[model samples]
Target: MKRAAELELALAPRAEGVTLQRWLCGELRAAILAGRLAPGCRLPSTRDFARQQAISRGTVVAVYDQLIAEGYLSGATGSGTTVAAALPIAAAGTAQPRTSAAPGIARAAAADTAGTDDAATKRPRLSRQGQLLANSPFLSREGMVLGRPFSPNQPDLGAFPHALWQRLTHQQGRGLRPDDMGYGDGAGHQPLRRAIAEHLRYSQRIDCHAGQVMILSSAQQALDLCARLLLDPGDTALVEDPGYPGAARLFELGGARVQGVPVDRLGLCTDALPTAEEARLAYVTAAHQSPLGGTLPLERRLALLAWAEAGRRIIIEDDYDGEYRFDGAPLPALKSLDRHDRVIYLGTFSKLLFPALRLAYAVVPEWLAEPFASAISLTVRHAPILPQAVLAAFIGEGHFARHLRQMRRLYGERAACFQHECATQLDGLLTVLPITTGLDATALLPRGSDDRAVAAALGAWGVEARPISFYGMGQPAPPGLVMGFSACNEAAIRRGVATMAPVLESFNAAAAGNRGQAVAGV
Candidate 1:
């Protein structure tokens, strides 16, 4: 049997602020859990320990009684005290002294850390879908905080009506009903939905009612819901070859087999539509094709709708930056031509108002309305009601329309500035495509020059641009840089293009040298 003096010598120093009884109980428990005090080992008698510590015997007895009750030890009138043969719980592994800067904890801590890695390895791995989503571009945390020069798809944050928006938000908050603060209608605020429907009718010429619209946290979330609700593993989904990578990644994460349909200067090649029997759905940015900036011609729009209707397939039309088109009149949305209700029109305030709003809407067919609402409830509960209410007021009061007009003028001038600077500084080095619509301008690199390397080089010099190859989805896309003008002012656009001139020249020169080497080898 271990003596009271020997046990006391092994105990760690007690901490401050803990009761004496707790300190003793904790040290004993730690010792037992750490396996330093072997199972069934005899313990010192309470009376003896009390004498050793110069405390009342009652305190020692109380500690012993509590530990025995917790199944850490066993005691009876004649049994003397002993550690339990069977513990009720797994070893706590290691522990710190109760609220004290106690010595001797280092040994126990070492024991704890030794098992940390082993314990982690024993845990289950991420599911296949989870692993795919984890590695997908949609979930990437890079380039999310955009405001860097020439970043694509970002709106002019500086030109947004912050004061007016704040006023509307404050008004809505003050006037909110008690019900407004609770979980909102899963379909979203009725007034906001109505406002959106009316806005679409006027701007995009889409014939939708408030009942068909469901507000969501973002266009991405809307697509996620669509994927979960409509797609099963191995379903064939078609997206533009040089299209939005986020959409393709989302469908892939949902276990859909995503195929890239080639995009030409006029957008998705209607003649190249995969047979109706082949694809289940197609996602398109018809108002302005993403990254490439092509507007789908009316004939192709009709052809796409005909194919979807004939196949009973779905078409997701993302009218992301339709309001900012500078070329002629903005074309009617693809949904406006959907005679068979196959098109789901997706729109977002993130691009129009600001990204932080995180508000977007989906106008689905009547058949999907209820199911989509139910899905929204399961996925996000509902988009916050207060922002919805404020947006409703903003649109209803004509502020949203006014703001859109202001942005159109502002972005138009910036786009012109961007074009002029590129023509002046980069005429020989790069081909600057016409910016007919959308926030970004796509400039093609010389053939065989690596756009990705150029993009990386630009980042080092404090400018940002997405290489077109990133959106190519393993297919061949024209190598280029997508430089956004919407987020930058005229002066910033000039400076960005000026900075880009030398970088592109260097890459072009390098490509020429590489070509010369190839010819010499031949």
Candidate 2:
């Protein structure tokens, strides 16, 4: 009957990408909790379970090993894997542990299971905008968990200079004044601002002084601040279709009417932008469009500036992946071409370093600098001074530049290798899009399909590819997957693609079969 239960587990809604291992893990755990698999119950041997389920032995072994690690199962020499003899699940209304259980482990299990009861408590009311942001499917649920392979926009964290960073952080900490430890300027640490200004002026070709730079936690923070300060409750904001969701969400939260302007291969369609007097703020990633990886041409950039100047409108240029373009000379930041001081340049160290760094900056015009600084003060006051100081030193010395140079090369190589694998292994299965910038690239399905489900299936296969539809706020979006190469090594990319090939091939076969059956009936 247990063998029958294992086979039954295999049949449950697996089309949602419930892998054999995951289903078994969930089922076995549920059984143990419900007392179906009693304490000390012997689980089937890996070989036997795999035979019953018609799945690979490795999956069963993996499930067994994970359960052992999590204390839901136990294994010992000569003793087969067994349900943990004393699970820490409490009775309906009690917290007392079973007397026969291992000490400490029972309490740990009880606490883990207790979270469900806590969650079942009543929820609080949220504001209208808060509800919109929360219920939006585009919003990310990934919080604090380590990123998986092939996740988009992820940097090669393994390449970070940890020892040097630790040294810099300690050195900065040891020298902080009482003022530094206490509340500080919202604009930023003056030294870090000066360093950033100098770096941008010389490297990014953005001419600005330290006074014009306002430091924030991330580019998302910068976007939210700008929207709050600039847009009224009902002002219209122009954003790129298939653009970064965080920007659109922040603008919506500010009670602004967001219009998704269409984009093409060359990036945001400037001609399609609302006429000069209609909108106030335009959020554009000119260096590299978020999902599509297109660089707005110099002509288009000039036109955008002219449009902004004519209307006295503001442009927020998010140069997130500008430094990672694998093709052609890197173009100057949009701020570099600003003659009317209408562009607010936003940059972040998250991509350059790691996400945990929590440091980003915005370059405002001289007239708005004071107002921007005041707003930042009211918001989060300032980023944690310690990391800011460490980053400032990292840039002040040549380490930052050297790291960027090395990362550019490493990402370039990884991109090339992944592209090569796609060409050789997935030529007919997926129409790989041309990639020039960003940590991830796009690939189209041969036909319109449920990319969301496909993306979920790919995730189950240990691959990461965001559904193209996930990036769209407007209707009639394209169907594809945004596959990332930066977080993984060449071998992982290769292995992930290999795992994907059969799934895609099976879909193609089924689609063909359906068409054939239709034609025969017709």
Candidate 3:
């Protein structure tokens, strides 16, 4: 008969100030590595584990996440967690001694072999400066640390229906059949595709059938698939000057020669499109332009569509945050008006649901749908089935619409509070760039001020705001900080900005001192 033992006894002593969650994770990891726990062995339930370890259930969950991320365990919906099938092992045998040959011949052979090995192992060199900058873009760095982020593109996570999601997830598990656990449809869950089609029709006035919507991992993937389908190595693609970096990077990486088209208040100047040669694709965020946050006027939209038809170019419209319009009624997506079948519309649930969900869809023109679907299937097979299923259920059950309504109210209040605070506190010190729609909130800093330095100082106070310069295509941009008000509450907004005021003042004083020094030196 096999014997069962108490794994809890193997735990190490807890260090002072270390979280119980961390300690439990460390103990569980050690027990697994020591082989006290074997592959296929089930973990105790969260409640049972917490009782056994004399810790909270939350602590157990954190430990489980750590183990899962480390590849030590696997988790299923109804089934309890179990150990992974295999663990990495180091070779046990010692190295064999080399036999001697003629010194010159051995040296020559060794050099040749080493040269070949080095060549094989060589990786694409990432530029050091580029890597450093890329690690955290100006927007990401500032937004992550600033006390009250005033940048756009932030979502109100607190208002998300976590309890409802948990309940739905449990319900899904209870009703899911055995076959549902296997690989799903390559395009996406059929129900999800249908649900999205209905959603686009009702919400965005899009005229797409479920078959036209192809699920992708993200808008980035959508862009990648589009680039692959439309662009060749030497092909030219037009990108907005101040656009989403995610789209710009994807196009460049696909070997398309990218040209930046300037944006005025009307958004992506169609007349400014380089006429030197015909381009294969033009990428635009017409609904709510990135960084500048201007909605493309209807006339300009028609002009862009006309331009695309004239040049036989495909227009990639990224309507990333289309649902969050605060002023007037939401406009129809560009794809809705593409009678010529020249526009490929990209939309994402990332902003609406959460960034971690990694669920997005692309509406391909009738002519391109087959090719795009084929490319997606060949590349990633499809987006994961579970998220699609959950989202479909969420939408079908009307939870999605309800959630959006709730979030819209919350975000509107927060935005109002942020704008009021900015006007009252900063006054002439900053210029609040008008954002009448969507989730973007931008404010230009004093001219000649180091926006990067100001953002860093705000980070010291625990407020995260993105710098506008990070969004520029080429050359330095105007001094400004892009603040996202969606995630914070009125109190947090007030506190964060109140904390940031002194930092800005101090920065301004330092700048004046530096200028005085420069003038004296001259």
Candidate 4:
């Protein structure tokens, strides 16, 4: 028997929201199951473990009692404690116990659910739609190293006015009404809805009132609610190729057939929009095409509206990063062109304020407002009210506008620096596309060059460049890197570009050599 002093048992620091006893039990159980604690191995006294871990002896005793009840450990008044000799997990690498005298081992095993049959422990089956959502790329953490240089669609979190936001938060907390402490309205705080309505009207010529706005957790939530409310299984939903994967995933989650329409320099090609017979809905990033930063042209916008009107179809216009257009006067949102009231416009504070805020707004037609809000209520109730109130105050007091102006200028400078550095450093390797609006920009790789491979190579070097191919659902777009400069400062952008240059050059050279070899073989 190993001495208690030689056991070297330790507990990991407890995680938030978990009790000390539960944490200790989980760690000890893991040790037993992984064969780290052999069968018949004596455990330290609860008093000794409590002293070593700086936890209460009662908690350690409780954990041991619980583990014993679950058949993981065997203990008696005088026998101290030992790992269960007859644990069923022995076949899975845990050693069989050398001693069978441990008290209540058999009785505990019979009582414990852990000894249940394999069929009882199998994972629950998912529905077909649930399977698609489960395997979604949107949930993938690949290339999602936050604060890394050129991480696509990421805003400059370092530049957010944290002090100002905290001040507003504190003010809201102080002024909260008793009603504010309760579950909030499904449509969100009235003041925030009004503020958003006013801001949209003034900035984007969107004709809306507070009644038409529904605030939810994030743009994804808003889209999910839209999918739940609007799409039926086997129905067709049109999404742009090389567009937001999250939206497509949401629509697919509702069992809708997500058909990707092709996009070009001017955004989604209106000429290619199929007749809206089976198509129930269309989603577009009209302000600036996602992955490829091109504003939808007025001609295409009018044509799209015409298409929706002709078929009584719903159009979801995601103006996700429309706030920072550096080129010309901002175009009115596709929502503003909805004479037929078929457009549901979505906007997010995640891009504008910060991602962690997790607040976004949706402007639906009068007919759909109640249902939409009800769906949100039935789903998530609503976004936290205090943050909603604070954002309302932020917009009403002019801080939102001030911040927008500051970010636009800062991001513009970063964009320019990024493009210049790309031109100087990656001249022969790739071409950085012209940036007009949005946080990220696309840089097309040399024709036939492997964008995914290049992106992987760059990721290994600490640069997070998402390949554009990851966004496509249909015909592939040009091999390109969707790199963001907004999250990275000018120096980091320059450094990122410098790092990418040599790697791209080597790949390009190899590709050329491979082409020569192919031609020689032919």
Clashes of 3: 17
Candidate 3 lDDT by residue in tens digits, 1-522: 332223344455676766777666655655565455677777777877788778888878887887899788888998878777676520111111121322233343345445465534553466743563365433453336322455456677666889988888888778788898887666788899899999899888999899888888899889878877888877889888776676666666667788888886557887787655548889999888887777898888998888888888899999988687776557888888899989989989878888778899988888887888778879888788777888899999999988777777777777788889988998767787776666668788888987878877777777666677767787346788887888777888888778878888887788789999999999
**Whole-model Cα lDDT per candidate?**
0.84, 0.81, 0.76, 0.85
Once fitted onto the true fold, the runs of candidate 1 whose alpha carbons sit more than 4 angstroms away are: 1-121, 139-141, 276-278
Cα lDDT of model 1 by residue, 1-522, tens digit:
545345753666677676888778877777776677778888878877888788899999999999899888998788798889886443444343342433456455555656687656654689887887777675422653476687877888888888988999899999988877777789999999999999889888989999999999899999888888888888999999889988988888879999988897778887877884758899998888877888999989999998898888999999898878886657899999988889999999988988889999999999999999999998778988888999999999999999888888888888899888888998988788888787888888888878889999998887888888878876688888888889898788888888987888888888889999999999
Q: In model 3, what is the error at residue 512, expressed in angstroms?
A: 4.0
TM-scores for every candidate against the unseen true structure: 0.81, 0.75, 0.73, 0.82
How far residue 55's Cα lies from its native spot in candidate 2, in Å, is 54
Q: What lDDT score is found at residue 482 in candidate 4? A: 90
- In order of lDDT, best first, we have 4, 1, 2, 3
- Model 1 vs. true fold: TM: 0.81
Comparison by TM-score, 2 against 4, better one:
4
Runs in model 2 lying further than 4 Å from the true structure: 1-124, 136-147, 517-522
Candidate order, TM-score descending = 4, 1, 2, 3
Q: How large is the C-alpha RMSD of every model relative to the true structure?
A: 6.0, 13.8, 13.0, 6.6
> Highest lDDT among the candidates is held by which one?
4
